[model samples]
Target chain A: MSELTGYLRTDGRKGIRNVVAVAYLVECAHHVAREIAWPHRDRAHVIGFPGCFPNAYAQQMMERLCTHPNVGAVLLVSLGCESFNRYALEKVIRDSGRPVKSLVIQRDGGTRATIRDGQAWIESTVAALAEAPRVPMDVSELVVGTVCGGSDGTSGLSGNPAAGRAFDRLVEAGAACIFEETGELIGCEEIMAARARTPELGDELRAAVAKAARYYATLGYGSFAAGNADGGLTTIEEKSLGAYAKSGASQIAGLIKPGDLPPRGGLYLMDVVPDGEVRFGFPNISDNAEIVEMMASGAHLSLFVTGRGSVVGSALAPVIKIAANPHMYERLAEDMDVNAGRIITGAASLDEVGEEIYRLVLDVAAGAETRSEALGHAEFILTYKSFEPIGPACLPA
Target chain B: MTTTDTRLLLLSDADNVLVARATIEAGETIVVSGTPITLPARVIMGHKLARRTIPAGTPVHKYGAPIGTATEDIAVGEHVHLHNLKSNYTATHSLDAARAGAEGQEP
Candidate 1:
């Protein structure tokens, strides 16, 4: 019923943009990978892990990311000495029916030769991707992720709930929406559990938040940052309540991990906190990391709500920045897409901003570039982490 | 300016503190429920101001939920932040103090 069209992939998923992902297998290959994608930076992006040590979770994340619907092709740049299984990752991309190539700096006559060869592949692949089929797409087929960063007191009051309003509209229209950060959801778990579709799912939701609370307790830090206090936010629970507003009022359909896709259109919670004994230093290193995780789970776009202001965008998906502070909004006008801060100034109501977000989502899906996308903000990040499979209670059959 | 111009926003009905929609100056008078109250100090935008007298160790409410407990007695219209409030579950850290002093917000 929507006027949107998308690039059709072999996996039956549609992509808003056919991005060429130039992935480096480890830190050693980062420079070469960056150079190869620099000429076609608008269409190609660099992403990868820095660790030489292999982790099953990192491998799985890379596989999901390479095969993500938005990615039309992938180039694996390996230093050859790292333990990352570049061949396996390359095969996964090839099997997914996208063009795949690999270059080893150690074997391909070092930096200059590897870059020269990698750029040629990218140049040709970019030409081929322009011809990828465009099929009709709908809101129901779109997956959106919402996250709040650099939040202040105004975040919950204005921007977050506005985004939540948009999420409500999207979910009502049968679109899949994901809201994450279980650590931030600490104070709101019972309320979140009450909205679960099933009693068993409610238990899972509670357990996940419980795990986050314990995890942070062991880490000797809450998710609360120093900037948060500088902006008048005193505690983590207060921040959780504000962040929880982004989930909207839809019934919780399921709980998912970083790379897990929602079975159908509804709202799902991504358990971002790492399972086990804090093997990974933090659940997500920064805002960009969580955005990457959302893209790995098939999110076509993300709504980033910021009061203190964040300018970062994702490599594969577009980010729509919603400014929560009016003063900060004026200071960073070019970086903002939605001025939710207007709600506080009495220029716009909460629902108006919400409706505005709804329209913007549809407009963006129709190939309109977000401010970040227009400003050349294809920022990316990935770190080591692990996840156990989701239990039956997490997703209702 | 019009009286409709909100200098402070009460997020939830059960909230005990009102968030400053704009930076309110020290000694500025703000009408709350038709009673004009004078602020003793400035409240920055996105910061909290006490709606009523709050005793030591009472939960401070925002968005109708307990954000943390008050560290000391807080009077009406006073700024409520890390100096006076702390999380019940975990301690908040800031630049100055090692435990429960400042941060904008994070999740």
Candidate 2:
């Protein structure tokens, strides 16, 4: 399958959209960042971390995001005195050959003055980005990620498995499809491992689930929350079985932590848990954080499956929502892209909805705006965490 | 001697039990390994029931793996839920108890 033409970046990467970013360095800088993006709307989008505390993980995440494929330029809105490493972060973006500017509210006259300067920079950046070169894209060059949130009883039977169908088709088409949150794959570890391409890779898959189990056990909870329980899931492992179906039946290509790119086009698992210890409050504070990590790993688009419903989209990627429950689908029809619930009600088959999702992925990659993106749901969040490097066995050879 | 009715789904040959696709009623006749017997209770769709008579605390198998253990003796077609089965590591509740707890709690 040939991909549609995409915007070619100065660094030789291709993007479906050219977006200008406004990032808040701390909670204090959030309001200014929001105000700056509020007027531009489509052209300028807001993304940021709020913790005043310095985190290597946060610093790394910021660097990856500012240089992501969809980002044409960056405007860093800092409180000027926050502990974040803004200088180094901005340098990373500039080094990628993208336009970047930093506004330290403390250094600039004040909020009113900085907003004025930020708007001027954004307006010019938008103009220059309009002139950025366009080039033909290859289907194999795409990185797609999938996630399921707000799951109800029907998620596994419909939305998740339908996402699995789309994932399988995407991988067959040579797109690097990623499914993550190892913590949610706890009970399905054995089955997941058996699907790995090689026996060694199989062991690595099992170990990742074990790590998630231990990590969550220490916290006295599984990746499951109160909402999941309210939605008819009885135990952690039951939730695991349903969540794991989104991975599809593809062979595991490799395991990558946040900020590590997949080696090639295949299915990969993003280990959202930190490499060691339980110091971080939780692996991810919300679904958006997981989406951000997927973007950092080079996902050009995301397939978000929801049962209870979430209307979140990424700043640099299009999010296609597959509604899991028919009731929820009826309520959020305009907000969602596909209703996998039709499979449960007998209106459609899993393969049909899956094909619908697969078609939507291509349609979005070809430049259609997702409902979330159209409604201005550019939600982003990052936080403090620590990690050691993955061992040699973590990835397939 | 006449033949009896049975439904089988081998997800994989290695699997010990196959999942029930539709509800099976109590006292309904089923034949496994050429032996005909009546069901103990109604087995709901998507829920696992024993392929054989599994003793108490034996791991209940599904998807070719152990999902949980039988809390009480589970016969073929018995409703396998909180009363007769529980999650291996955590707790599970039957819809009845869950609904009762819901009704008992005042808003």
Candidate 3:
């Protein structure tokens, strides 16, 4: 394994990079959020949601994001009329000892003045973040997650398996690695179950995937994307077989819901699909929503595989794009990290590409910005959804 | 890493076809399971070639997995995908109807 290093945070967690974030509580606050982030653009970013109504999922997502290890300081821009829990979110960040400030549009005399005040506060916060001392960090303290979007034929053979190799390396180094979208794991239940450390844990793993399928079926969707069909994939079962490969070869440590943190270090499944009747349209509207949940659960970085070319990055975590199709990789070389499609082209072995990805993870973890991050693609989204709390079987021993 | 006389041309390994890795011009001989067969037309990369005579409604296989079902009887070396095969999981049609209006859909 290559030697790894990172910027250590006050929480004893290692951050791949230090970034300041300006958050808009609702669509109405987006402008001020952007304005505040603009002045400190090099070190600061604007990230927010467009929803107006109060959502438990959104609030929880916001809390997790504002306090993410990568963010050294946060500025919350509230419309002052929206129902988002801005105060609670501010408190979470403040309590974590990171610099945090909330600017309410209503109290600050609307957009113009709020932007002025917000920018001033953000500039000062950025300075403070810059002055914060960086401590020594280790590889074992890292948390990573993997998700695939725009999958094609090479995904199962190359991209996902390559990510699995990286996950295996990360886990062996004592880092927490997570792979999710249980809705896509429908057909791999038996295969996934066999990898669990214990029979009981194996059964729980299968049950979690079953729950995701049932939840999606309630919405009349099968987690089958149109792109899957376009890429020579034929069935949800076939897609599941590929999607389940992202978990790597680690023994299943535990099963978890969207926001639940792993109790101990090992590979875990994140069930992003909601429980009960599907009140919300789909579990996750886009790929970034799933990425957000994994970040909230403490993944410091994300490995994103795209066969059809996805150019998205996360707001708080750096997203490493692994292109699975050789043609797609050639077309989108500027936006990708490692091209697993080389395996299909027979230019590289699966293990070779996998090792490349594994090495890339350590480099990205040690402060090398990914193509998506350098392009400032901080795409984030949170939606309305309800989840029945997990039962005892979901946690590890 | 290239194997001689063993293309191992897998198409679900359950179906009766070899998926095209590149465009196979008509009359070009390709090896599958050490058996040399000629192409009927231009078979695009990512498309499939019939491993054997495929009957209509038979499930098409790739990587030992069923990708879709055949909509018509396909002769050996014929291109498979939206034109000849359709997805059983989702109601996607053969290659033509599926790729209709969305040319260059693949990267």
On lDDT, the candidate that comes out on top is: 1
lDDT of each residue in B1-107, candidate 3, tens digit only: 22212332463536565654444466877765445677655544455566777889987665565656788998765666656676444343225455567553444
Model 3 stretches astray by more than 4 angstroms: A1-10, B1-19, B23-27, B34-41, B49-106
Question: How would you encode candidate 3's per-residue C-alpha lDDT over A1-397 as one tens digit per residue?
Answer: 5356555666666666678888998999998888878877768877776789988877877787777778888888898889888878988899888878888998989989998998888777777777666666666778899999987656776788889988898899888889998877876778788888778878888887887767766666677776666676656666777777788898888887777778768888887877776686888888998998998888889999888889998877889999988888888999999988887778898788878987888788877889998887888777788777777766658
Kindly state the fnat score of candidate 3: 0.19
Worst 10 residues of 1 chain B by lDDT: B98-107
Q: How far out, in Å, is residue A383 in model 2?
A: 1.5
Restricted to chain B, the TM-score per model reads 0.76, 0.63, 0.64
Candidate 1 on A1-397: residue-level lDDT in tens? 5898998888899998898999999999999999999999989988898999999888988999998888999999999999998888998899999999999999999999999999999999999998887899999999999999988878888899999999999999999999999998988888899999999999999999999999888887898878787777889999999999999999999999999999999999999988888777878778888898888899999999999898988898889999998888988999999999999888999889999999999999888999999999988888888888999999997
Error in Å for residue A395 of model 3 = 2.4
Name the candidate that leads on DockQ. Answer: 1
Candidate 2: segments with Cα more than 4 A from true spot: B1-56, B61-64, B70-86, B89-107
Candidate 2 residue-wise lDDT, A1-397, digit = tens: 6757787776666888889989999999999988887788697889998989899988998888888888899999999889999989988988888888999998998899999999988888888988887688987778899888877555766788889998999899888988999888888888888888778878878888888888877876667655554454446676677788898888888888898888888999888888777887788878988999999988899999987777788788889999877767788899999988687666898899999998998889888889998898888878877777666776767
What DockQ would you assign to candidate 1?
Answer: 0.49
Cα lDDT tens digits, model 1, B1-107, are: 12222677777879888887888776888875455777776677888888877899899998888988999998777778877998887788777565444532222
True lDDT of residue B74, candidate 2:
66
- For candidate 2, the per-residue lDDT at A168 reads 94
